[model samples]
Target: MTQYDVTLEWPDDGTDTVAVSPTETVLEVALREGIRLPYDCREGTCITCVGRVLAAGGDETPGAEEAVDAADAFDYRRQPKALTEDERANGYVLLCIAVPRADCRVAVGPMVRSEVGDSPWS
Candidate 1:
């Protein structure tokens, strides 16, 4: 059983960490653990589940990047710049598609403040 420790953080906030399987998507672990991560599609089409990984301490490999739709609330095309190269390089990962790459520590939530601003779901 491959287990990955996941650490999620919010803006100007602390961290929420949980242990999940390498085969599991971060969103699955989060939802199961009662962590309120806003996401529409369970697939990888929407960007509502975009976040960033801070570190990985386990022994799993990262997953692939998926195409994001422009209609979603957090669409890349809708943003100022659809996921700049630097942002991707900085470890910005989409939770819906990103599987754990070891026991990783990350800031999982809407990367954009405005997307989560009006919602009290966080």
Candidate 2:
């Protein structure tokens, strides 16, 4: 199986590194590794698991092509209801359903926390 490197950066807890298989969601991998990321409905109906894609590949230049490529790189299996098309274009992803197609750097939003005890999911 192929694996992709995922780096999650949280405001309070700094950063965490994990490897995810193409078949696994970011949240699933994080939880399995004991990394606490905030989430409400694991079903993608909520925005609690939202994170920003700080970087994906070398396509940081903002343009239609970059946006399309970013969308193609991150697999949000279901329609991410919590995010607008503009938000999606801007690199926001719902971690509960996001499966990276390549190595990705995610900026954990303010709503997220890292420590196991600090997690609302716990």
Candidate 3:
């Protein structure tokens, strides 16, 4: 089985890197590894597991002409119901419904989604 490293950056604090397989959601691996991540519904319908895939480790400021969204790092099992297309294109992912496809870093915690406007579940 192939695995990828998913670096989870928690709010105001910690970071953990866990191995993830394309066959399972990141949350599943996180739960199995005993990694503490805030989650409620284990579905794409909620933003509880929302994470922003950072660009360039978020170390330096990105130039206005150099925006990079690493959306290809993970695949959405279902059409992401909680995120707008813009958010998806901008590297936002719902870890509960995402399967890693490549090594990626994610920003997690309360601050990440305090104002996320999700698509209405119809």
Candidate 4:
């Protein structure tokens, strides 16, 4: 399996890097590594686990577009209904369903929750 190092960057908290596979959700890896990220539904229907990609570098995978920019760094396991079209196009991803296609920096915590709407954190 291809492994990616996904860094979670909080507004004021700091950052945590977790090793992830193409098939593994970023949330799964984050929790396993003890880097507690915000999450509620394990599915893609909630915004609690949303994060914004800040930067990324990746190679293209099968059935995926190249990670030319932060917005293109991940693939959702299912349709990510929690985000608006603008959010998705601009790099917002629900970490619970997001599989990294490359090494990336993601902003989580209150910073992200506030922007996504209806988040428990906000």
Candidate 5:
């Protein structure tokens, strides 16, 4: 299995780099690495895990030109419902379902407790 490098900017203003398999979601890798990323409804229904792709590639090259647009970079196997068309167009992605095709830098948002119910572990 091929793995891609993933750089995640957490809600608390910390950054972490980890390896993510193509078949796994970004949130999964973060959690496994002990990186606390905001997430709710691991199935992609909730918007709590929304993040923006700052950059994406096999190597770390800084600049907008080197970055992959989150709108186009996200795997289409599962379309997240929390984000609107405009939000997606603006680069918002649900980390719970996003599978990166290349190394990626993502800016995670604050955790929003689910209105439906509180997570027992949270």
Candidate 6:
């Protein structure tokens, strides 16, 4: 199994340093760590787990799929603002669907939580 180092940032001053496996989804790890990042479908179809790649200072390894271009980002399961090709190339991984191929540093931005309206379920 490939061991990857990952860093996650949350709005509530929460952070995590975890060892990730090549087969483990980012969403799985984040949930295990109790991060408040939003998630819907655990598949790539949802963009709720999408986030920015803060740093990728390692080997250029082939990711799960070709880097998603801004246009393709929209065609996914859940519609989200398209991320620039550069962003996707530089290691932006959609947490729900992305599994690490190398050690990575990623930051989930604050806007995701801001958009969550008062939940009728809650």
**Candidate with best TM-score:** 3
Query: Model 5: residues >4 Å from true position, as ranges?
Result: 11-13, 58-68, 111-122
The candidate that wins on lDDT is: 4
lDDT by residue (tens digit), candidate 4, 19-113:
89999999998888888888888887878898878777844232344323335789878877777777787678899999988887787997778
- RMSD per model, one decimal: 9.5, 6.5, 3.2, 6.0, 5.6, 8.1
Q: Please rank every candidate by lDDT, starting with the best.
A: 4, 3, 2, 5, 1, 6
Model 1 lDDT tens row, 42-69: 5544557767655555422335253222
Q: lDDT of all the models against the reference?
A: 0.56, 0.74, 0.78, 0.79, 0.70, 0.54
- Which stretches of candidate 1 lie above 4 Å from their native place? 58-87, 111-122
- Candidate 6 on 36-108: residue-level lDDT in tens? 6677756554455666554454533434344423232112334223333454554444677666655655657
TM-score, candidate 5, is 0.75
Q: For each candidate, give its TM-score against the true structure.
A: 0.63, 0.78, 0.83, 0.83, 0.75, 0.59
Candidate closer to the true structure by TM-score (higher is better), 4 or 5: 4
Report the Cα lDDT for candidate 6.
0.54
Q: Is candidate 2 or candidate 3 better by TM-score?
A: 3
Worst 10 residues of 1 by lDDT: 68-77
The parts of candidate 4 lying over 4 Å away from their true place are 58-71, 119-122
lDDT of 2 at 19: 94
Model 6 lowest lDDT segment of ten: 68-77
Which digits, one per residue and each the tens of the lDDT, describe model 2 over residues 1-122? Answer: 99888889877768898899889999999999999988888876767788877677654443334433337458877877766677777677889999889887777866432211122233
Query: What value does the lDDT take at residue 22 in candidate 2?
Result: 86
Worst 10 residues of 4 by lDDT: 60-69
- In model 6, the runs with Cα more than 4 Å from the true position are 11-13, 58-87, 112-122
Q: How many times do residue backbones clash in model 6? A: 2
